[model samples]
Target: MTDGNPDSDGLVVAAFGNRGRLETAEGETLPYLLKGRRLKAVCGDRVQWKQPPQSHEALITDILSRENALQRFDPKGRVEIIAANLTQLMVVLAPTPEPDLFLADRFLCAATLMDCNPVVVCNKTDLQHNDALRAALDEYRQLGYVVVQTCAEPGGNVADLTSLLTGHTSMLVGQSGVGKSSLINALVGDAAAAVGALSDASAEGKHTTSATIMHRLADGTRLIDSPGVREFVPNISASSEVQLGFPEIVALADRCRFANCQHLREPDCAVKQATADGDLSPRRYASYKRMKNITASGSV
Candidate 1:
């Protein structure tokens, strides 16, 4: 775990509780434990650490500054940071478990707020296709979001996804039963096995099941696999900033009669006018309204 050096820098790979694995600057992987209770680390964190004397594990001492963090509201309505320094967010969806466009919208909104590129991945392409889901994906594409269709089964088509993930720190997120795990297994053949080994070694197999694990692709791409959730609410600090999540809305907001129009019951609202004129997606506008109200109320 040590190169005879007192301290070294490492990247967090799999974080569960205070114990996880970190990859050293020299590409060596070592188990790590947080130095203090207050020090919270997540996948993709660049940290300073050192091997404790008489111990085999590294002790994470300090977390380096982050470029940005992806966060969401937990069940208790508290902000929970999911990952750090993410360059791309892959929102995976499937035909099963019923596609939640609202939830997808929230993830995309969160990605936008974090300044990360968001890609919508439609998994399980071999399953019976839902026209409604197809239309929804089309709407996202029309709005300038990249939508990639993939099947995560053996020999499934994931080439496009691989291309998108190259040279980026990407995280996969979506509802349960969306085949996120399958995609991970397909993308990195040994990812599932490595996760199991790490969890077992740390005696955190059960807890790690829901933990975010980072995997490295052969091309130097880093992928963080997050547990699927039933619902996701982005931690929007203010209602005024909600419009920033919706690109189409932001583009038209400048034309609203009121400079600070919320686009709700505001006369001559360019967003409302666009919705009425069929220039903007009504469903998307409705989603924006829902998120706006949620943000204003500071709850789900």
Candidate 2:
């Protein structure tokens, strides 16, 4: 059989070399080699490659354009691109399993810094619910983000969540045991990821030992299942940009007494006043203070 034109483009990624590779859009993961001279590739990178008929292998030639990329600092302090061309980030949190506010804030800030729409997903709602949590989440909904509540075990609200992901490439980020894998199974209707039960000792879900991978949902959209994260340090482009990430803070910054108020121990700070008057979410303001301290440390 004649080979397809090598110029016909394909998505190129680096995977465990021993794992079966991906060559085409058929959803079958296949193995391929980086034929070019020492080029590093990441997930969601588009490239042109050709599969050799003689063997079950392929070769990558070039990387195409990237609309936007999500990156973070690695342990070596190098910026690593986690995903490319993501239109949205589905930040998952489960209340029945217990709430993890720090993890949620980290994911939200990272998504905002990376310029992707951050949507909140509260899973396992059937087990437990809190009015305060709902009201706090509404703050995000009012900011124009789509928020959805889901119960993964009984398939509650999974269909509505699926509809929101249709036709967009999204990344799922949250802490371990947030029903991320369970929700993935519910949405895709397949056990693509192993499901673990919550721990008896700490009421936290066990981690699934698997590599991060991307899968296309039946709705014609791509979803990347990233490994759950425990910590996220914000990489603000500028010290001033930190205010921009906090919606309420940005609104109140202009009214501060000083043009460059840090909002901590500063006289006549509008943000501090707003926090006192209940205009800003106390928890959100606390998170902002923690982040501001981190930024002030010059560690970023």
Candidate 3:
């Protein structure tokens, strides 16, 4: 499988463990196996593959360069890449299972750092909007993130959601109970993603998206559905990178007394002053501080 001659340029459409499905330039979809442990592939990755004379699967020989990748640290403090070559990061959240604002902040930060558009979609609008959810969405909107309230199951205002997804490689990411799969099913006009119901006791939606896979809309837009997670922290190399992830912080950073203000315990810190003056959401500032601490510690 690792030998020469049978070569093709392909795009990774699905990723599961060590193997993935690659679509060739000629439009042939084939199962591809990795050439070695060093070559890891994810959805939207451009790759080169070769097939041995009598091999059943194509061997992924090389992974092409990526424009950008969404990444975070695993529990063991190892780097975990969510996806590659994404133009949008769709952070889905809802009223139930308790929307984690901090988690949403992390995803938005990652998007800003990656130079990708971050969208906040509040699904399950059939459920009454809790105060916390409303506050979170309002804050995000105030911060200039597009926030849409959608009812994926009953197909309410789905057209508005669809309009934003067109012409971009968008990824649906959030905790398990946020109706991401439901939104996918509604958008793609099919039951491609498995939708799970909330448990009676736990009030949490079971994880249905088991793998990271890419699907295309009729208009040629690409969408990736990622597995639900309880906690997420973006992978940042340095403390300076943390402020770059927050738009408000970056906007006010120049007004700080020190050029290298970490925004924590520094004199005349505009960010801290903004939080104190109610110009910045305290919750987001707290999120920034916590993330700064995580990056400063050099561990999760």
Which window of ten consecutive residues has the lowest lDDT sum in model 2?
194-203
Candidate 2 structure quality by residue, lDDT tens digits, 1-300: 145564546664334432223436655556777665565556677766677668677666666778777766555555667777788888887764466675577567777777888889988878656876787688778756678888888637787688888888787777767877777777766545322321123334445524455666666577777666666555555666667667778788999999998787899999999889988778888877777765555343
Error of 1 at 145 (Å): 0.4
RMSD of each: 3.5, 4.5, 3.3
TM-score of candidate 2 against the unseen true structure: 0.82
Instruction: Provide the lowest-lDDT 10-residue window in model 3.
Output: 193-202
Tens-digit lDDT track of model 1 for 1-300: 447675688999988889999999988889999998999999999999998779999999999999999987777878888889999999999999899998899999999999999999999999997999999999999888999999999989999999899899999999876987778889988777875554422354232346788898877789888887877878888888888878899999999999999999999999999999999999999999999887766566
Ranking of all candidate structures by their TM-score, best first: 1, 3, 2
lDDT of 3 by residue, 1-300 (tens): 334355689889887777878877876678889888998998889998877568878888899999999888888888888789999999999888798888888888889888899999998888898888898888889888999888888646677678898899999999986888778878887535323321122435434667777777887798888778888878887878988878899999999999999899999999999999999989889999888887766454
Note the residue pairs that clash in candidate 3. none
Which candidate number maximizes lDDT?
1
Candidate lDDT (C-alpha), each? 0.88, 0.69, 0.83
Give each model a TM-score: 0.92, 0.82, 0.90
